[model samples]
Target chain A: MTFARILQVFKKEMIELRRDKWARFRLVIPPIIQILVFGYAATFEVFGVSTAVLDLDHTQESRDLVSRFVYSDRFQIVKIARNQQEIVDGIDDSDAAIAIVIHPGFAQLLRKGQTAPVQVIVDGTNSNTALIALGYMNEIAATFSRDYMTDHLQRTRDGPPLRGALVTLEQRPWYNSGLNSRWFFVPGVIGTLVLTMIVNLTSFAIVREREVGTLEQIMVTPIQPVEFILGKTFPFFLIGLGEVVLIAGVGTLWFGIPFVGNPLVLLLGTSLFLLSTLAIGLLISTLCMTQQQAFATNFFVVNPLFTLSGFSFPITSMPTVLQWLSYLNPLRYYLVIIRATFLKGVGLSVLWPDMLALAAIGSTLLAVSILRFRKSLD
Target chain B: MSAPDKPKIRVAGLTKRFVGTTAVEGATFDIARGEIFGLVGPDGAGKTTVMRMLAGVMRPDAGSIEIDDVDVVADPEQAKLHLSYMPQRFGLYEDLTVDENIRFYADLFEVPRKLRDERTGPLLAASNMEAFRRRLAGQLSGGMKQKLGLICSLIHTPQVLLLDEPTTGVDPVSRRDFWRILYSLRESGVTILISTAYLDEAERCTRLALFHEGRLRYCDTPKRLKALMPGTLLAITSTAARDLHKALLGRDGVMSVMLVGDGVHAVVDDADRRVPELSAALDAGKIPHGELVRVTPSIEDLFVGLLKDEHAS
Candidate 1:
């Protein structure tokens, strides 16, 4: 456990990494590419949803209502349908994801001061996209109805004195006023990419030597198990830290996602998260005998760490059993820390508990790995 | 016995077992300081198991190992400070250059920079590998790889060196060069334990331990091992060598018969009488042959003879 021995190992690892072309490619190329792709692709907001407009009431009022969907910037009316058959054809052909239908008595019903119902039909092929598009349609229709009601009341000034001044609600969204999903996704990429690179690298560290028959060579030296493990994993820890900075800076500056929290808080949270993830890799390294076995085990291990961590799917939405399992996944806690830091601008006052959980998991995993590592050496 | 006073390596009742099989059972031996000890046997004879236990890379299931006053089983790390082991087919990092591999190992052993430079310079030159230092370890020939492995193990100048079949696949020329480097290391008083499949290599060791089927069948000098043969050996070279082999089996005065390359080697009670009798038999079979020549038993001849004896009883 001496520092000198550990530093020697650290130096060797760095030199090896510097020379390994694939390793260098993984460190530099993939993080940038992943951030570029995942930041934009992993979005909950769906725009340009092709819609078919079927306006039976071909009046100025019907035309004006159809314009609302177009102006929402979320839909494109690719087809002007004459009837239900045309709308059906558009949706069946996959040409339109949704259709806005106005009945023939739509304007007459509004003129009579009664309710006018607009039927919205959606394609459910990709349920997530369908669900998000449906939400956007609801918002657009609500705003149009509110405006039309106000205008109708002004034209009929004698209408029962209008109870309670027509109940107008003003909504204010905090932190992200326009609610950009990239603001949420870009910061999470920092955690995901760091987890992926550091875990995969560290997990293969000892196993590669074992497969190539160098581990026995190392074990025959005076280097202790703890010293070797620290030396092996610390280099990846530094790389993961550098990546967090690179991604956080890129997300905030390049992608225009705001970073409103204390950098020190973000740094602390990230280091703790890196500690646990690197320990997880070391544990995997001890359990595996070969690089291929390590890779297979990593597939099972990392896939769960990614999916179960509320990266794309919310843990609260999962079953109670899975939600409980997510508690053990360090990524779940790190996600809360990273998302809160990027979006909410909160610090340790809000994130101390998750930080503490990370410390506990990291230390426990590291201790176990060191114990198993020493045993495996013999 | 040539250790002068105290032995550098001692073992008592060393044993290791895998599930449903024993790898080494109650093995006991001592290696003196500065002795070039050979672990000799055919493949799967537990030679490697014995070498691994001595190197402290593996723990004996039921024995004690004391190396330089250190209990290797209970305290392998301490024992490691005194020994360097080159396992069978030692794998150097292919991506690293030869110099980088050496420097990396030197650092692990905490070799001082000045001392490392002094030693590495001559070691590479001695092995004629000084020019290849910058080359990646993967790019080197198999023999060069084994040489580099040996060099890396020696950077620490350990008290004991363990080499497991370092020349198993190397060319004869490289193997000669390899033995030269080992002889020099022995001159420096580094006690070495080398396990080899080639019986000729066993003759070069100051002492040899013959392992067979997980047991040490014989432990002594190569000279003494050949002295253990039951009778004089005769070499019968013939064109019909395979037939000559069958003809010599189960004959009186003949203790054992083995078909060697283009010849048959047999141990007999009396070489003179057996030669005449064997010549008569070969003549009856019309097997054209050369004159029967009496030769000293080689380590291989002795190993084959011992293995035959073990199978008999």
Candidate 2:
């Protein structure tokens, strides 16, 4: 391949891309906006869940138990009801996401050293939030019971104070000490945003030329098919790298997500990821006849890729068949590498397998796309 | 015409088929050096197919094309070094400026920087587009775009230039300007092969090949092709031209009658002998006539007669 001819094609495409105002807007603005919006908005951590409480006993013990639920940041007591019917109304009217019903004998049973159960009702419409809310409530109740039994034993028994039969489990979360969901989701957003933009930019590269009649002109030159494909992909590859840096910056500075790994490793992983995405775009362009068809096909391919990449949902949560299917998605490997590097501060030794997978899939995609591109030109 | 000196371009039994249809069949021709050869035909007459094959962009199914002694099908890259093709669309990047478009082609052809700088200014001036060099190609008028396409194709200064319908949709004034540029190029000794659907433009070429239904019907100079008319042609103007046309359709000497403008053009076996019989017939039919005179046959007349013969067979 002649490098000068390839450079000419590359320069021409870059000039046109710079001059096209709509394309420039699409390339820069959407990724920035999407990264910011999805980083803060798309999270599974439930906070400030509106709660209602029905305390029928009116005792100090009952009041103490209600305070435990209110003090936890996960639940906010928005309504205090005198009867069970009021709590039901709060939940049914959607004013409260969770409701607590305390029976009149709650304090009496606890004082008699008998087990007392409190009914916790939750709205199941948003199952993830409801499940997290239930876990918080259970922990609060268990803590309240343990403290009450210890006080009773210390006050009634003599000598060294009879210790109650209780087991305490210490929980320590690693990597993300606070278990911040943004740390998990922001890196995932970077993977998804970069993939979408790069694929879109390269997907229409060739098909647009075909529709506008420029491909025929380029084909008549002495440039080979490989040179043309390289010329078409290199500019978008640079743009994809730029987007990764931009979104990663946004994730770290604006959202307070940590970037602990080596920047060079991130760069290496991103380049490999871009290779596969750009090749997929080239493959789609070869299959389509027009820009509209390319756009439609891009959407069809990108959605499934994002889903199987484990961007939002964990791959382990999917069915066995779909979990196996995720192995074929290059984005899955990239997301693993990105998230690991960002959160865990891991190096090549920890991420070598994922990096190898990315390289394998990327080179294979590039080879297939080159073959398809040559065939289409012929 | 001499066998010793090689022609600039030579084609032998060039054929092309698309899917289930034959677009061009057994076409053969030779173009001399420094001559503007025209491929003239109507739409769907395979003018584009022939131009594409000559451009070395498409392979002919059953023929050989040699350009400057290089086999185009065997080594298109070698042929491309000595030739340039401007397709029907011209494929100008709409977003790029006129100057940028020309520079792009120059770069692809690997034209030397000094040579490009020397040639670009004069080319822009020659096309009368120097004032709009910075304008985007999409914003230019259709005629100006065609001029820019010509400039881009000529930037490399190839030995052979193939243009497909360069003036098809251009305005008449721009068409005249484009031809002026072409003539200047011809004077510089560049061999040109241009295609057009307009029969009038056929007269401008040094020689032309007329195509109909993917077949080469005639290949010669415009003057020679017109001379191949089978019989005498007469132009008849009458107050009731349609009535006169209907009256002369079945006459003894009349070969064919067709309406031309507000008059009737007829081909007869012997115009001098049939004039009296025509007058008597008109008188007998009581149709008043004027300006009934024998005239030279035009290329349009020749083409129509050829089409008629093809249809008859």
Candidate 3:
């Protein structure tokens, strides 16, 4: 309503934020630390899985297979098993994550142009790690067998066995040619971190006043409800935007993630995302009566935003019911826009749908929060 | 839009309920311009509820509240321009300095810098808080925090000020200083309605309203209300005061008996005659007793008497 009143509240809040040591710490230090921490910690690509090898063949072919595992930089051989019992001990003791067993006839089978049977055992404790390890093992074995077969065909002058299987396919991944997981996660850290910071900042800012009894003090004044609400949320919106810039800077400069899309589109997406998160924070503030309650509710609300927003997991892999629910998550759309813009270098033509989704969700949330804000002014 | 003859704040039949229980019922009062009206009651007497409704912060379920002849329930915003309310715990941003806190409230009320500074200087000096202007509110003494709350509330030069238990937990010295500032504000013609749990503060108010269990028991000048007390109150002390309460109940000369902090306060029909009669009776019962003194009737004395009267009838 009145710009002067709203501006005053905004200025007061900014001053408080600046002077509050704990709030300042939460805003400045954690985002940088979290971006650096999560960029490295939240990756999906598996490397250097501890492995045990039981080579009974004692032949060049068996050694070549073991060398492939080493050269691939995927499996680190922690123990060369003398017997079957040792391989079992390595896996059971958690000293090794996976074990490879090459039979005694492996070299004879390969020389006679027959299939080589390789037995692999894995620790299934962390199912995700086990699965990725299996995938890496499969690729390395396929390459080893394909190279061996081509050599055999050149020496013996015989037709290729498993013709289609030995077809040398060269895989070139686009956009993140290295398929680096940091490239994916760093861009997303900007979203998750910003969401967390903005929500906590906005929610705590209002609920702390209610707890401290300032909310009622302000309500008794001549200030309009709209002006108060605008004043309360705008600071957080700017803080959220500033956070995006902070994390994006760290993401590009420190983590070496590329920023390829138009800055305007990123800014637009950040604005919409901030609006929705800040609305969510305000709504939570209205429901709570104390800072402790606000903290718990923010955790309760933001946890789902992270998990269901496809920040770490794929939305398509979720159950149909949850997939439908993801449509309501603002972070879900923002993550898509962030990852797309950062890696694919796509523009509005490909991102308008997500942008529309974000706008719809953000405006809807903001309207409800404002309505609730007005109602709770008493 | 106020007529010269009208009261500054007129609240009629104000009632409010929360969930299924009534917090304030059929409360009616008026505050004249420049008057210090004290709403005195014990905890849960609905004093704060009445102050909240008058401040336009809490909407009464059924009532009309007019501040400066402006309808409050229907047009709270318009009425609020002339109103300032201080809650039981005046919520100051503790991270902010005292000066910053005052400026924030002034900005909220849209007070011009020239006027705010002019008023703040005198008010701060009167409350003796000028030295601590730059201190964070969280770091101030409890007494000074209350003074700052008053300063912030008065920054706008509002016509009506509503303070709910502003000095409930403050020290005696600070409370005296607070009352001195309030008396000065009355000179400027600002009608103040303050809710307090302290009955002794009634002596400082131009008028007082007594509340008990969501109802206004008495509303008038403190002098007039004290005159309405039915009987003389006798302060009887013995080796065991609880025993005195039981022995005096339903006695011939005593109307009712109550325990007041390790002593018995007996409302007797006539203190002159009842004092000797009670002394003789205590001797007969072998209860060790002291000389009886007739204590002046206060708002609390009348409240205890009114509660007894209600229970008897």
lDDT values, one for every candidate: 0.87, 0.88, 0.88
lDDT of 3 by residue, B1-313 (tens): 1433768788899999989889999988877898899988778989888888888878899989988779999988887889888999998989899999999999998899999999999989988999999999999988899999999999988888889989988999889999998888888888898888787887778888888889998888888887887879888777788788888899998998888875888898988888889899999988777878888876777878877887789
Better of 1 and 2 by lDDT: 2
Task: Please tell me which model should have the higher DockQ, number 2 or number 3.
Answer: 3
lDDT of model 2 at residue B45? 91
Candidate 3 colliding pairs: none
Highest DockQ: give the candidate number.
3
Q: Residue by residue across A9-109, what tens digits does model 3's lDDT show?
A: 99998888788778777788989999889877988878899999999999999999999987878789999999999999999999999999998999999
| lDDT head-to-head 1 vs 3, winner | 3
Judging by DockQ, tell me the better candidate of 1 and 2. 1
> Candidate 1: where are CA atoms >4 Å away?
A20-25, A52-72, A80-93, A99-121, A139-169, B1-5, B91-100, B132-139, B231-297
Local accuracy of candidate 1 as per-residue lDDT tens digits, A1-378: 689989988888888888887877777777888898977788888889999999999887888899988887899989999889999999999999999999999999878878889998899998998999999888877777777787777667875545325555687879888877788788888888888878888888878888889888888888887888888888888998889988777787788998888888888988999988888888888889988888999888989999999888988899999999999989988999998888888989889999999988888988888898877766
* Candidate 3 TM-score to native: 0.94
lDDT of 1 by residue, B1-313 (tens): 4445988889889889978989888888889888999998878888888888888878788999998899999988788888989999786988889999999899988999999999999999988899999999999999999999999999988889999999999988889889999999888899999998787898999999988878888999998889988889898888878888888888898888898997889889888778888889889888888888999999999988988988888
